[model samples]
Target: MSQPVMPAPIGKRGRAALGMDAQDLSTITERAGDGLRVLGLRFTNDRGCPAERFETLRARLGTSFEGIEIDSSPGNAAGIAPSAHAVLTVSLVDEPGHPTRVALDRVVAFLAEQLRH
Candidate 1:
């Protein structure tokens, strides 16, 4: 007789698997206004690396600004893929145009630095 094979254990589902909850997601979504443009750097999806980075940046930036919103796409079927991408938009309460551009640049720079390590 042939022996039975056991299936592997599937990891946690969705963004929670990446260590994020509803509150976190809500906060980010609420913060993103009309002026901010979120820049997402590709990272590992198995561990929710992108979401983690976003949270980290949000914490570092403080709560004075409006907020950051994330729009993520579906994850790939492959194991621990990096296909998931998020668009973060920061709302502008002040003047538009130049001020918003400068803020966006700063946010991008911060994200880049975080991904460096």
Candidate 2:
């Protein structure tokens, strides 16, 4: 995968999925020798479509996810530009304890979110 300098993560800044919301993010720690190392990734605006928005989002998200690591540098510089959507790909340091999956369990148990409501 590319480094944090790959693209600039940008979009609507809110409690969206895969964002700062407790419902969207998760944390993972890997064992590196004698200490633990948390993982980090670069999130760009998908592209540089809205340069201004990307900058704002990158700045805001710079320190949003506390437990999780994020990298924002490589802003889109091709046909791909910033947009309001993203294809999710989450890698966890461990299994069965990730927050995203735990939330999903609740949804699955109810068959539908409306049932939980």
Candidate 3:
């Protein structure tokens, strides 16, 4: 039986972002909720989290998972980390006829968006 390797604590920015949250990232999840779900994460190179590579995922979610609502916040903002992989925090709510699709359009489109001096 091969046990999966546990991930490291994270980089400097990851810790900083996780710390800003009072409850911390521990409160974040990725399971179906009572018509609602929230995902706030800082994607690190060490974690293999995707930033602008959710088109297929989004398309699948939109078509297969009907009535699923999603709200996303991805990037390094005030309380977020800088130069991290990608912060993909999303909230889903499946109410009545709302008419909406999951989108990851944020301040930074990709890691290259960050102007490194």
Candidate 1: count the clashes.
Answer: 7
Better of 1 and 2 by TM-score: 1
Q: Which candidate gets the maximum TM-score versus the true structure?
A: 1
- The ten-residue window of minimal lDDT in model 1 covers 1-10
lDDT of 3 at 47: 36
lDDT-best of 2 and 3: 2
Whose lDDT is higher: candidate 1's or candidate 3's? 1
Candidate 1, residue 49: how far the Cα is off, in Å: 6.1
Stretches of model 1 off by over 4 angstroms after superposition: 1-12, 15-18, 34-37, 43-117
Global Cα lDDT for candidate 3: 0.27
For residues 1-117, what per-residue lDDT tens digits would candidate 2 score against the true structure? 112322343445322223234432222111222232222322344242233333433433443312211222345322222332221233222335443333334335534633544
* TM-score of every candidate relative to the true structure: 0.25, 0.20, 0.22
lDDT of 2 at 25: 26
Q: What is the C-alpha lDDT of each candidate?
A: 0.36, 0.31, 0.27
RMSD (CA, angstroms), candidate 1: 15.8
For all predictions, the C-alpha RMSD in Å is 15.8, 14.2, 16.4
